[model samples]
Target: MRLTRYLLALFLGLGLCAGPGLADTPGVGLKPDLRLLVDISGSMKTSDPDNLREPAIELIVRLLPEGSKAGIWVFGEDVRELVPHGVVDSAWRERAREAVPQIDNSGQRTNIPAAITAATYDLERLDPGYRTSIVLLTDGKVDVAESPMVNASSARRLLSATAPNLGATGIAVHTIALSNEADWPFLRALARSTSGIAEKAESPQALSSIFVQALEMVAPTARVPLSDSGFAIDDSVSEFTLLVFFGGARNRLELVDPDGARYSANSSDVDWYQNQQFALVTVASPSAGNWRVKAPDSASLRVNVISDLKLDVDPLPNSLPAGRQTELGLRLTEQGQVLTDAEVLAAFDLSVVITGPGGKQLSIPVSREYALPADGEYRIVIPPFDAPGRYQVVAQLQAQSLQRELPMYVEVVAPPEQPTLVTRGQEPPEDDFQAPLLWLGGVLALLLLAIWLHLRRRKRRKLEIWEKRARQLASNDSEPLEGVSADQ
Candidate 1:
């Protein structure tokens, strides 16, 4: 199964658990784990199991969050060998990949009992430190075994009756019946058992769709901020596919267009990590306003995307002509109150298009740096303008953490027709730079150098007397000088 291949990835990425720091605890994070249980029945052979290919593979990938862990299992009449329980890592994914291609209708019936048991057991490997979960996907009526104490129906009954135990075990079971063929009795029982809900899908496509939706519904989403020291958007956007970085775990996010038409992305068709891996959202364009989490499909983590946005170009004629040498300053602002210990992504400029007079065009790149999340004006240095004529300084403010960009505009004015370097005391002027400040600093540096030279000369004069005395003593014989130098 592809999942088998990820055994190493899972092991290295998600495992153990943590919580977002304590009130007094310093440098602490959250640890959480979610297990995926797949039902591989003979009927599943009719169509390819493993969500046809992807949904199953994504299991371990989704769990690769910081302070988190994931495990995998498949039950076909009986639970297939554990896929990624020990050292949960990329190898688990590899196994999942290996498991899917060879999946056959081997099992005659679905075994909910063994499936849930395996899932719960895999979770037991972790201590009480993590948020535990079991995600079970199936599409059939469970055939109750002829057990004296509990039949399949009775087992289903047990799941409901055993809710507290599941919770106390740090386990929560989320149930999804991929097809109408699923057994509601068992599904409902499982949900009631683990304080989870039962969601049903009508078609194969819908099934896959609901599976992804269900994952997002229960999966955690993080709130992150976007920064662009160059040009960035302060105006809000929405319906954009996005992602939020939360330390080790990233949230898969989707923006729904508020276009009066019921346009929404089916979870199965969407990617939770589609946006920049765990990015801080400043503005959700097409959204009514700035960033906020809304899971119309399922429950999602509460997140807020806010930014203090400001942009500037340097050498502030604040304006430049195309092809002229001038500095562009960029200032990105964010609400410092928020950030949550996250770092702003590296800054960059995009859309390097320049529209010059008479429709001439040119392009250039601006550079930036990253900093701690704070509500302040961060800056970037712009590169030289590339074209001539009245041009607009156009670029998109880009952050490594952002999926989209904030747009920027600059007014490019022509350089002086008869350009002349203005000297101090002669500027009525076209540019206002810190030339005076630079001159002051240069003068101070010269003064300090002169003072240092004077001190060295005085010290050299004082040392001359000692040197002459030493020379006079040396003129005497070694033994004579040693005994009578002072008397001499």
Candidate 2:
């Protein structure tokens, strides 16, 4: 009990400091915002050889594209934007170079989720014209707080929450794991979710090369302006999705399928981004032939299409008892076939939304590791419901253009009925007398033991008294016992 109390106290303490606060004030930066999130927690001071982190930052700053704008954020227990995003001129470069050394190893905790969130905020502040990407460098696993609630699962949920923001803003997150202790899988997933890259650095000296590699990944490798000339996919291709990114007011865009079926930006399959800068359309089993597009020539388009990845959640149970643990299954497939290997689908986001009897909603946290344990089967454990009524579990996956929501309803029944034994041709067995008999026997045994002890004590006292009287009589006879009195 004492140990349990101590552990509860510890968790409470951690929960108090779990939040990563907020990011620093907005800095001035345009698109192509390379937000460098460097870990400067106390642990880095030791893991970093000769404190070479600063030198790596200096090298990255020097190599930044002259046309691009950037910012520097250092994260530990708290996130601080050391240098806000600004144009990469000689002056800005020099400022960044000097500011690199100013970042000291003074932080005591490494709040990785907060760092990602802060970087996302920085990119969000920029216009859609500016391509946004983040380069995260860390040497340890997420250690935001020391508590039972702050584990790898918690970190994943935090990442899941921030991933959509990055996706909506088209901000890629590239990560460089500095040491073996780093959460490499989580970092890789974060990068993959945003269409970025993940790499590892053997030592601090290798940081510069890895940073360049990340930069290359974030850089635009190709530019094909889609206007009068539209791209097409042959029938040989299985599935594809086209993401059209633009800026300014909404453009009137049209897509013509191989069968001459016309689809506008308002089509059901087409999703117009709330950001007002992009439209996403998924074409499953694309038909062979030339697909045409019609749009205002003034509107520029950057098209991104991918294939061979799809997420689906298995059917949920029709009914569940209120306040009972229930597991929801999820599956991932490629081209309509379920995937046997879990690693291939680790980059996707799987979450659960629960609606209670009172219309209250809650999102449960899930971990990637849990899915692999069951080979692509994600079992989401739902807490017992408090009221018996209709409850819902909505399983959702946000992977690139293939976002799916699967909701299942279950009617929570009241607690199980108590069974009563029935007998034919005989009176119902009265309450078993064993309990009363046991109690009576216990009382009788205790009374008998007490009486026996009392009798033994009394016998011992009588014996002692007789022995004393006999000794006194013998002594009187030995003393001549008043010889005259005896003769009388």
Candidate 3:
């Protein structure tokens, strides 16, 4: 019980310090430190023939918030740093975008261990203010050598040595297997052991979406809901970016602002980066009204915004023991102050969707009754977990003008097996209780036998003493008679 209390206290302390927050100031919250590792082995020539990973990497780089740190590494037989690790800014984004073209299927071997080691080389020291993670994408097995034994040995080393080391340093290693031929078991185990996520990209076309999901898990940002390519921009929004996936359409993408003014790639105020698969556009000081995107028929859009109104969620721990109850805390803040307006609070809808092992999902609606008295924080208690496996919790918050989703991953470990008590009239398992019961019975019988022998010996000794005394007394008494008898 003392150990459990200590662990819970430690977890609470870390959560309080490392949780992400959004404030009116730009860099006043927890920052994300993400390392991306891409596999460039020869098998990628078939797995990713269209090279969709390039755009996926570019999209993730562009979407990273300003204060976060990110770097890229490409691995084949060896590892090469494509982008220098640094704070995310215009220059870093540009460097990452330029380096995306260098990714190709030119190498001979998939050296996953080397890639992980190189990517996490500088992450030995942990920063409480930063959330560090690694996103690894691969398409083949561990084939660093001709001998299968050597490859298997490398995998074992990774599981036994590297994964634990990374977990100890609080670095999550999210793995993405790009094809069916990839070493999925190894990747899954690595991610699960390190409190990260494991994903599979069935085709090259699915890489970008998977990358976006990973980004959400690593560095979640508040978003404005874009329904049917249209979203609302309020006074709180300072800037917003539109990530439009056009599905290889050749048509120009245009954005309609609140004033119904259309802007395209050639617009003076918009920064646009176009690719064969998607177009990323950024607008500063967006007008307060409705905005729409004009793109191809099948285009999908996501709007990420910078605003003073934010929802801050407490961070979940990497792993939890089974049957442990967890309380998830969330606060709605505006301009660095807790929002207490009853009208706005009434409009807020908060809930969580938990996906457990084997694709089981549980939806929980967080009621306002769970809110604290005066503070604008809502503490929702999660149901105690019964099963043990990886679980994904997505906290969704929606208001009249804003929507945000935070994706968190956690591993639920089975608790230690406890000793079972045998009740009266209930038979215990033979394997557990039979030998001990037999030994105890044998000990009791031997104790009874020893006691009986001791009592019998004592009785015999007393009898002999009494007999000796009687004999002596008779001899004494008979001494006078003995004279008479001798005389006789």
lDDT of 1 by residue, 1-488 (tens): 22212322433344311312101222122244667777667777554444453433343343344335666677776887545653345565466556555444567667777776776664446664455667787778665565645555556465655555775564667777777667777676566445455666554444444444344434333223332211222233222333333323433444433332222234444333332223222223433423334332232332322333322222123234556555443333221121122222233343344565567666554432434323322343455655432344444454333323322233453354887686767655644657877899999999999999999999999899899999998897755435556656
Whole-model lDDT per candidate? 0.47, 0.63, 0.79
Candidate 3 TM-score, C-alpha based: 0.71
My TM-score estimates for the predictions, one after another, are 0.41, 0.39, 0.71
Candidate 2 vs. true structure, TM-score: 0.39
lDDT of 1: 0.47
> How well is each residue in 282-373 modelled by candidate 3, as lDDT tens digits?
99988877898888887777888887667666667656778999987676766565654343455668878899988989988774445532
lDDT of candidate 3 at residue 83, scale 0 to 100: 94
Tens digits of per-residue lDDT, candidate 2, 1-488, equal: 32223323543554522322111212211225688999988888777847767756765675565567788999999999888777779889777867887878888988888887776674535665466778888887788778846666667785687765675567777788888888888886776566556678877766655665455444321111243546545333455455443434455677788688988756676443322434445566666556777665545443333333334443333344457776766665443345443333554567778998798999875655354533455666777777977666766655333344444555565667889887766654566676888999999999999999999999999999999999898777445455577549
Could you list the CA RMSD of all candidates, in the order they appear? 31.1, 22.8, 15.6
Name the regions of candidate 1 deviating beyond 4 angstroms: 1-29, 46-56, 59-63, 86-102, 122-125, 144-153, 160-163, 223-488
